[model samples]
Target: MEYKHVVNRIMLMIALFISIFLNLQAQSISDSSTILIQRNLRYADAPLEIGQDTSSDRLLDLYLPHTKPMQSLPILVFIHGGGFSGGDKGAKGNVALCKEIAAKGYAVVSINYYLYLKQNKIQGASAGANMKDGLPKDGKFHTGLETAVKMASADTELALQWIKNHAENYALDTNRLAISGGSAGAMTALYTTYRSKQKILPIRCVVNFWGGLASTDDIRASAPPLLTFHGEQDDLINVAYAYALHKKMKELNIQQSEIHILKNMGHAIYNYITKNEINTIDKFLTSNMPAYE
Candidate 1:
């Protein structure tokens, strides 16, 4: 009986120690004064009367780190992918990813842009043709895609402009701005930063997840540091696109650019990126953006 009683006491003590350790860990996490997330911020309003019609897809969600070192934080603006057709700023998976990035001591914004559906009859007609025949019969297929990409790029630029206009309000360091996106959104991010006429912010880095530029020519000697993630088996947007971009980056002596290819992975690499991959991205961003360090 005495031996059993001693065993019970030891078990009780172990349980108590575990409980205390868990409480301490929880407290440590809660006490860390970092990571503030704000959702549904209207960075820009639609129908800006900029020579054409627009939609209400100009909203964005922000993730911020509260522990500001110099009262300024590096910013990452993310655009969602839907092939210029469909997608939302508040995607659950992306929001979770942005929050994780924010926890790593950076400001993150996921934005929405004008879709191809918002364009005039030309876009509608081209889209209809694309739906029937995987490719549009109208020689205007490329033109329509270009127009859609340009519109989304324009909206992305407007979002950046909005951020620049409200930098102090958001505690953002415009000098360390970066852009990221998936697929079409990734294309928009690259296009907007590389092709836009209005150079609002000095982009520090780019995170391209299975994305390609509308024009490879946009890549110049002055292009910012780039980190690309693509799947080797991506059928929708061939892995070749990423390889081509990396080749150009190398040719241009953009030593800071890198492409990570996931073996046997497909177009949905974004959905399957592991925690370790995210950590790698965090490390890349921190290494490139000194403010995060």
Candidate 2:
């Protein structure tokens, strides 16, 4: 009986030890990831260019997980909104979104593309419109705006090329790339996805925050999944553009696109991507890129 009791005690102790070890292992496995950022990495090869508030700095900030880089991290390239003439890569509000996304194990590349505006006013909407200050229409932005979009789109392509060149060094999975932007930056994202000529980087998803497309006519049935947030009271870019984009995608049978309109809000909805919305965005990415699921 004593020997049997001793054996039972030993088995009980072993079970407890195993349970503790398993708990520790589980905790370690589920440990939160830390993010590390490397800033001011030049992406453009052209002679170092500068713009208002360093807009054409041609630099990009890379955000990655602080772990053993196995060259497997998916990339989410972000552009800032400044009407193509003002914003920089280090804007604080947008940085919050970038960091939060990075913390979820994505490599976020916030880049600086050439700004297209500086005290310049491009034609608003189209000649006939309704909304604020009339129509983008209905019609697309004028030449200056169009040129800015094209230039910014080109620069964004260069940034993708840069990301591809350094993919191995940063554990970036170029095959799984997504681009996002706010306001003008959002327009650039759409341009890069549908208009950019270089096929070096294939975008899986787009998160457009208060951005207007040059024309919904540019999108096709095969375009990437879109997730957009627009403020109905947007004073800069009209909400009609967002509706037009959504309508176009619907017509094309692109079922994965979605739009969220915020009432009484103006432009700059990117700054207000709440925690819930972030989760939704993350889910959108995961769903679009099933590998992340």
Candidate 3:
């Protein structure tokens, strides 16, 4: 009958509406997603060899697009934070970040550096008994921090150099190398971006999440348009450090810097919150970052 036909048409229209709504939601989610890449390439060892030992740290984990025939992806090298004493590439929180960023289609590399405190002596054995003498006497632990940063930075730069020398192998767009990190990893990221001297092309952008600014002079000397985030309630690496650093950069006419202080947040807020801040950071990295070669 005519009435039955009308009812069937109405049902079809409703189903179509629901399908359209679901498709839109899926698209929105994809707008904020990340991907991962898994592979290792042979790289020159000298760039990573800062000491007498000329060994290559070619190990890296990349998170990028999930499509067939991999596209040329932007590179993001992320470091972890364990006070330079202990930390691993497989750490849960950092791995989550790597996966998240990779889902967004950018290549992310989470790396492990040479840790300073092993058995306890200064540069002690990798696995051995406790050596209390290895511990710094004063509250200051600069030696361990310095060694870790140096190793991490060297590895990062070497990775970049390798990417440059073999760009076609990794399918990475060499022009868009960006560095980011949290805590001590933040120190390594910021230092590598602004403090160290490497032969590769300058890093295009830098992001610091809940990290401190060591010294302003070096940062200013090679400042590459910084984008930093910190939690206002972060007691671990006081928010003031970020604020003061921003102020100094502004004073120095470094106009392309930005800082976001999350209200009522604490250290490592990115790990606690939903991926909203992550999306913002991705936009900042991809869209708002300053122009650099």
User: Which candidate has the highest TM-score of all?
Assistant: 1
lDDT of 2 by residue, 75-94 (tens): 89999987765778898877
Highest lDDT against the true fold, candidate: 2
**Candidate 2: residue 276 Cα off by (Å):** 3.6
What is the lDDT ranking, best to worst?
Answer: 2, 1, 3
- The CA lDDT of each predicted structure is 0.74, 0.79, 0.66
**lDDT, candidate 1, 154-194, per-residue tens:** 88888888899888887788988889988787877777766
What is the TM-score of candidate 1? 0.81
Judged by whole-model lDDT over C-alpha atoms, candidate 2 comes out at 0.79
Q: Which stretches of candidate 1 lie over 4 Å from their true place?
A: 1-34, 48-56, 68-70, 118-141
Candidate 2 collision pairs: 71-171, 84-116, 125-135, 125-136, 126-135, 126-136, 126-137
Count of residue pairs whose backbone atoms collide, per candidate: 0, 7, 13
RMSD of 2: 7.5
